[model samples]
Target: MNNSRLISLLGISTLRAAPRDVHLLYLSRFLRTAAFGSTGVILAVFLSGLGHSDVRVGLFMTLTLVGDVFLSLVLTNWADHFGRRRTTILGCSLMITSGLVFAIASNYWILLAAAVLGVISPSGNEIGPFRAVEEGMLACLSANYDMSDIFAWHIVAGTLGVSFGTFSTGWITAIFQKPVGWTEQESYRVIFIVYTIIGIIKLLVALKLSNASEVSRPTVERQQDAEQEEAQPMLQSEETSVAKGPGPTALMRAVRIFVPELTAPTRSILWKLCLLFAIDSFASGMVAFTLLSFYLHSRFQAPMSLLSSLLAIPFIFSAASSLLASPISKRLGLLPTMALTHLPSAILLGFLPLAPTIELACVLLILRAALSTMDQGPRAVFLSQVVRPEERTKVMGVVNTIKTLSQSAGPTVTGSMAQAGNFGAVFVIGGVLKAGYDLALVGLWLSRRALAEHDDIVLPNVNDNLAENEGESDGTSRV
Candidate 1:
């Protein structure tokens, strides 16, 4: 009886596991991220190595943001219609094939063409469906576990990928014991092979998943109600259970762009968030492109191998920061915690130019990494709180696409300045601008309540209400 009781307890614990999908997603993302981290930070440096000018590198970088923006705006709704699993498989296939094609690209134009084909430019949206599917799956996995902890696990996995990828790149480049024809740049091409292999693994994992395996809210109720709706046909001797294509015409095209309107409260919050994001991102963009690679290259004259190792330091700090984020949020509150972290981050970023020794620069960068990233998890929570559930995917896509655009522009402008011999000034300018953004955020908080209590607001549809003066709502849930 005692042994049976212990077995039962173990089963319960497994059922209430903190992140049920950790194994499901961790390896796939690690593979994708490893290849991505190895190249993106140092792409401009690689381009410089190939004798391309900074402007050309900047344009190459800009193409990534352009793709993200285009895809998010145009294709996001298609995911809503086609089902997220199918969308994810398609997206991942594109991602995997693009990386392999990229390995063989011979020249700058070929590389640019590879980027276009791969959609490797820069896109969270490309990967967004995977998260949607996983999160929906996790909801079915456990009723008792806190969603926050699960998200934390997701972040932990992502950081591991980044740190591991960067570290491996540096290590391999540092000790290429084989007398192969692999140049430092060629090592990046090899990383793509890793990405393709992982993509295939994830594709296999995808096959094991079922659309109906995950339970959504009020699952039985929704199914019953949907069946009821389909039971009766009112017009033209036929009943349509699903919304059909809006039809193919110029008028339909115009209607598609204009029909889905964001609510007023959501619109207001979105604009403020966008303004804040744009300001913060411009600074972040500049830092993102130049910070690690340029500092290592210009100040320390570090090679690709050492550069990879040095890049690991920041991601390591980021992983630590994410681990401690819950306790930090509990102590500081969300917005204040974010502001406090950024103050130091901006200061450290500005101090980069002043570091007299390579050691000092690394120390400052690590410090900046720890503080700057503490906000990421909490910020995601805040986003969920501010938007309705049905609209969450579309809203997130729009906001993330904008953020990507701002980040994409940062590298281009900063690369130009660095090439013009004004790198120091750019750091100072970025820091001050970010500091101003921090101040603006603080002001926004001062005007509002100390903390926002989550509220679920559902609006009644006009047509549905007309059927009965008794109003009905598709339910919404919030904490």
Candidate 2:
């Protein structure tokens, strides 16, 4: 009984209740994000070391994201039809291939082509459909579990992965450059080689997933049924034009497939979420770790060891802070929790550039990290609770799609500013913009609070829900 309580406190009982495949998915994400952590730390400076200008580096980041947006859509749209496990393997394969090319290729065009054609993370976060597919698989494989715990631990795993990846790359590169006397390019290439090895391991993990991870016939049938049901009203409507009366033309059918079938009210809220998240993402992109690391390298001439170690500090905060998301949201409600925690982070980000020393800057960054990701688990849980189960994935996908689109422009703009010798302004503007977004989100929540609804649920009965969930998934083995 004591062990049972301890396990529950730790999280989706840290996968105690999860199926073997769910555990595999978490492992896959950890390895993949760690690889992202490795490359994201060096992506910008590596390009600059290759003699590319800041503008070129920024443009490269932007174009890579632009390509990724399309790649994500195509692969995710076909993920189920193509097979989830197979799709996962394909992502890993791309990771390996991309790493190998980045490790060896020097020509800017060749590197760009490799980045666009395969999996390369510009922001050191996920840039592909791997997240969505894996989340879906997790949902299916662990149908009875409380995803809040699962996702909380999920964020922890990814952040920890980043922490490891960044620390490893920083020290490894520093060792190669200072001790072994390697060139900057050589050290960076070694990091990519390490990334490739991780990718290979991730592929092996993906292969271990059972057939249960694939989309079932019932799920496919339900989707098709939902699609047809959604179109029925449109087809029957007098306003919707068809090739003929009542019947939807092939073109109309094709176009409608891209639309989500949600209630009008949910659609309105989701749109609001899209705008909020898109703005936040844009602000975030402007100060991406890749760019920030580059800034430190250029401005302070900080060693790779310092950059990696200092940057890794925040991921530690982020990982620890992620554990607090579920509990905080349960108390403050999702919107309040998101807005309150994020506002401080944004304020800290704004002040980051004002720091006269690297030590001070790291202090602000560490503080920001403590609050920045506390929203991730809650935001995901918000999506799950705000809409029907069927709508959850689609809504999350839509928000991510818009957020990525908005973020794609940020690096280029920031690069341009850096090239123009206005690097500090980037953070100021991003911080201001992010703060405004948080205020606007809070306003939205307050406006909805006049009447009792989901927002008010936290005030009255959130603890009850938390207790219920705890009782339901105790994770204790029975005798």
Candidate 3:
């Protein structure tokens, strides 16, 4: 074919092959993340403005993260069973409710309750069950496409939303507070109002997603195939004749559905992944975006508007790096890509506290942001590949829960340190811990790869033995 025709065919193929649900999920992520980014940048400052102490602000952030952990664990465990589309809609609804409560309520107790029960973002990232469930659904729908590429675009969408929201919140507050004669608190509340409106739009988009977005459970046909395979015994003739027992009680069955049943190999890999992710998340919590915003204000007496603008720089670079993830992972492989890209960012974080000036610190942070998130897409793809298809929801849920739980400790610690006049220590310690996590992750990945290779070799030998036994049984029947 001519070059023109060939190029046209490739373009059409790329666009047409991606499922509609994938696009809708991208939009949902963008809208939700935009809301998160806006609130995340100002949450700590907003609380402080309301006469809350730094410790209280930190505690609020911690509780918000902890709440997400619990809710995500419950919702994501049953996401497949409950329907991905429906669960996502529900999550969005919670987000809208959280925004409304934050916007209208001045009672500290009521605000805390809203934060705990509803979807709220303190990390300038995904805050509830949406990410895990959406990722699981994307993996299902994008089975026929380049999964890494799709995930990269998904990250890009989220990061862009965050960038825009972070940048706009500063201006939004400035616009409302100055010319419009709104109170500082009221200015911040305006962002939450926009957050609620975005949530409504996201919910509408989520509703448009088709049922094909749901996780594919094993059908009766698949069950029958499994039964036939089990019945074809090589040497265990008596085993096939055993009558099937009665089904488990309904209560027991319900419990079983919530618990993930993975093979030994898959479980081991999952555990290793969870441990590494927890370590990284804990480090991340120490300098979560909200706390970071607070730190800048307290340490440098930086204006809220400047802090917001500076924070947006890193997100822009992070979004750009996300676009490179797919091509880089294609060449370097998933594990190496994640380790190489993430280690540099962690090391850069170590330099953040040492910067001589605010400008230098911003540059360091922007650089860190560029490299830090390059692992996200690869990590998501890796997890999807490592587990059985049926267990993706459970695995993602468990992993995210562990990560969130680990992260919940960070804000509290950092907040206390800030109150104690030890803000530098928080950055130094978090950087050290994150660097350690990067090294450990590489080691774990190598070990898992070695184990997988060993299993690959051992499986064939066992299969050979089973085949020989079957031949012997055939000969005996002929005799």
Candidate 4:
């Protein structure tokens, strides 16, 4: 009975029942995050080794995120209409490009250009349109109730990948330097080389996704949209001959661009959610794991290997904590679970800088880790419940873009502070902002009322097949 309960709570059935495509998505995320994790550990150290100042390192992160913001906005907005698979492939390709360039080049301007033009993660967080697109796909790929379970395992895969990457990268960095007499930059480049290879593997994995992962659109409607596409430019071409105000064609096109992607009701709820998320993410950006690792290294003189081992603890604990998210959300509801668990974690973050010893800081971080990430699965489930299938991708894109835009400045702020010897304030301010954001979510936004509770918005159109994707099966649950 205990074993049965454990399997049920862990949602082992959900994993076993998931389709191959869903599994592919999970694998892609795991590989991507492993690359991200390794880079997170080494990026600051690499820049420092390159003789860049703290502020330059911070600016590098800021620009990386700013570039990410634009990239995410464009790709996510086009993903549903253009093709999810293509978007993912492009993203992976960009990751490969960024990793290769960073591995080969040491020039700051060149590295910054590569980062801005392609995909690289300095904060060790998801940094592209992949998350938004995948979340949208995941929402449609499974039952609404199973969403949280899928997300839980997804988080587990990601955290474990991070743990593996960070731990491995640390050892690799140390090993390469020990007897090989390799310089610090050479050691770090090895990780980026590995990152580039992971991107290739992920790209191959992404190519295997079945049509079941894409959003369903009607066949005739697709034909219509395609036909309209070929004629839109010509239609707009006639604007030169038209009488004032550009023309009807141009005006309608402009309106379409200006119109909100979501429905009025979804907008009403989601705008607030976006704002709260932006605030929370800004706080997160302030203490990105890379910066945190930098702080430890600079302040306590922690070695790279030891620093990575210490930093990886939270991801492991966070992964385990995510397993509890589904059940906890089921009991406490998503928002309540998110708010209640997060507040304490934020408080712990507030106290992190106060720790006089690394051991105490790790203890506080472990405790904070146990709670900080418990909300992810619930939040995914909540968004899936609240947003319609057609709008999910854009909604995620918009929200994530907003969050990234807000977060982009945080590392710079933290960087400036570290330059001034006020680095410790980053954690304190981040914690307080995060705590207040959690409260505002419940208090000002009334998120505790549970948007999913007011009306149980469910997805029921997984079979809305496309003509081009004619033979693709839904890849329904297994035995």
The TM-score values for the models, in the order shown, are 0.78, 0.88, 0.86, 0.88
How far does residue 423 in candidate 2 sit from its true spot (Å)?
0.3
Please report how far candidate 1 places residue 210 from its true position, in Å. 4.2
Query: Which segments of candidate 4 are over 4 A away from where they belong?
Result: 219-241, 244-260, 444-479
Each model's RMSD to truth, in Å? 7.9, 5.5, 8.1, 5.5
Q: In candidate 1, which residue ranges exceed 4 Å CA deviation?
A: 1-19, 121-144, 175-178, 210-261, 289-291, 450-479
User: Between 1 and 4, whose lDDT is larger?
Assistant: 4
Tens digit per residue, CA lDDT, model 2, 37-119: 99999999999889999899999998888777766665666667678888888988988999999999999999999898888
Candidate 2 segments exceeding 4 Å error? 1-14, 232-266, 451-479
Candidate 4 lDDT by residue in tens digits, 1-479: 69889998888888888888778888988998899999998888789889999999999999999999988988887787788999999999999999999999989999999998898888886888899999877776774237778888888888888877888888898899997989878999999999999999999998999888887677325534644664467564555646455675666556444232445556776787888999999999999988988888888887888888888888899889989988887776677778888999999998988999887888898899999988887777666656555666777888888899899999999999999999999999999999998898667435333443565532212122211234232222100
- Residue-by-residue lDDT tens digits, candidate 3, 196-312: 999999999998999788755552234234434543452234443344333233334455444544445567667777888898999999999888877777778877788889889
Clash number by candidate, in order = 1, 1, 0, 0
Give lDDT for model 2.
0.78
Better of 1 and 4 by TM-score: 4
Which residue pairs come into collision in candidate 3? none
Q: For residues 284-325, what per-residue lDDT tens digits would candidate 1 score against the true structure?
A: 777663344754677678776767777778878877777566
